[model samples]
Target: MGMKVGIIGCGSITKFRHAPEYRANPHVDEIVFFDRNLQRAKELAQQFGGRSVETIEELFNDPTIVAVSDCSSNEAHHINTAQALLHGKHVLCEKPLAISVKHAEEILKAQAASGKKLMVDHNQRFTKAHQKAKEIIDKKELGEVLTFKSSFGHQGPESWGVDKSNATWFFKKERSHSGVAGDLGIHKIDLIHFLLDDEIEDVHAFYAALDKVDENGKPIEVCDNVVCALKTKKGRLGTASFSWTYYGSEDNSTTIYCQKGILKIYHHPEHQLIVETKDGAVIKYELEPIQTNENQTSSGVIDAFIDCIIHDKEPSVTGQQALASLKVIEKILGENGI
Candidate 1:
């Protein structure tokens, strides 16, 4: 029998990612959608061949729902995910886990008490390029990695949010808390953690609202750009930048300096992973194009979530793993006075 899935939000994340992915999952036979705006819920339900729930309570109370995808606003991640977990459903929550570490811990406690699985949608880890990179690093094919730099930047959420405007909740401090750090930076932080198999031990960051403006043509309240230097527990050094003001094409790239070679990701158009060794021997692996809002592609997150549930195994990106990345985000926020 296929599992029944509940989607807690009907925003851009849900529309572009969760809903369609869940519909495509062979193990998912039913999907239920809930949104604060009833019409939004109805519309997604109609489009995805699912049912529209009038209230969050209605969605949670349904005993048939075996899992939930919490794609709500950043501010609601904790509440919505905890409620679903407590209601006996495995949850796949969108990243940053929670706006605060305290809230994230609370969700973890809820999962522990409920004996349910909790996963974070750190979709970058599921990318083919990133997976291949992990393989190379694990096999010591690049030798011992020493230093690295990564970045995730684009035009801004205004181009993709459900409302598609500066008025979106992403610009509201109360709703988003930390801007690019939480939205884009955290993904790379998680990716680094996944790739290096090490945790960031320290962070120093600089952030500013570079160029994004509000509905009134004034600077938004949140940081639109961030650059940081980080050190891992293993003494590996790295730099990262996140931005909502990369007016040109998106640049999601990272380069790792290792003892034997340099591993570059997303640095080539045809080859997603490339290595140039000390002897000048170069190797390239052709992988799928990076998935962006404009260049949509399957994330492999929903499928992984379902496979974990079906196999009764822990999610690849667990809540605790996400918390480690969130701690780094908190450190950066503290340094910036955000």
Candidate 2:
């Protein structure tokens, strides 16, 4: 029998990545959705041919739902995901995992007590180019990775939110907590860890609420831009930046300078992954473009989450790994006194 899963939110993530991916998954036979805004839930359910629940308790209590996706806002992830795990449902939570490391740890403790799978959607690692890059770095084929620079930027969440309006919760400090640092920076932090198999040790960051305005035409409470220097446990150093005011094209590029060569990711439109060796040889892999607010594609997170459930295997992005990344984000924001 196919698995039935519940999604706790009906936001843009549920609309774009989770619901559609679950619909396409052969293992996922059914989906149930619940949102604070019941109408949004109904609309998404109808869009994906799923059922909409009026209350969160309905989704949690349904025995048919073997798993749940916690796509709620950052602040609600701790409560929603922990409760889902305790309810005997495996969970796939969206990125940042939690706004604060302490809250993330609380959820981690719940996961340990529940003994069910808990995965986070750090979807950048699921890319074929990124996976291939990990292979090269792991094998030392590119020699020792020394230093790097990575960034993720866009026009801002207003363009990507479900309502497509400036009033989106992404600009609220109470709701978003770390703003672009949590939204975009955490992905690069996790990606760096995934590529180098190392953890960030120290951070020095600067952030500002430069451009975005809230629904009331006031400056956003949270920072829209962040630039930081990071040092890993393995002594690798790197610089990272996150922005919601790029104003031009989405820039999700990462360039790693190794001992023998340089690995450039998303730097070229056609050659998504490029390798430059000291011998003046260039290797290009024409992989699919990275998915953005404008360019939608399969994220592979839902498929992987379902595979882990069916096979009784560990999820690709575990709760602990997510917590580690959340810690890094916390360190970055803590630097800025946010």
* Candidate whose lDDT is highest: 1
Q: Would you give me the overall lDDT of model 2?
A: 0.93
CA lDDT, candidate 1, residue 21: 91
| lDDT by residue (tens digit), candidate 2, 52-85 | 9999999889988999999999989999999999
Pairs clashing within candidate 1: none
Report every candidate's CA lDDT. 0.93, 0.93
In order of listing, the candidates' clash counts read 0, 0
State, as a TM-score between 0 and 1, how close model 1 is to the true structure: 0.99
Model 2 ranges with Cα > 4 A deviation: 335-338
lDDT of 1: 0.93
Q: What value does the lDDT take at residue 123 in candidate 2?
A: 98
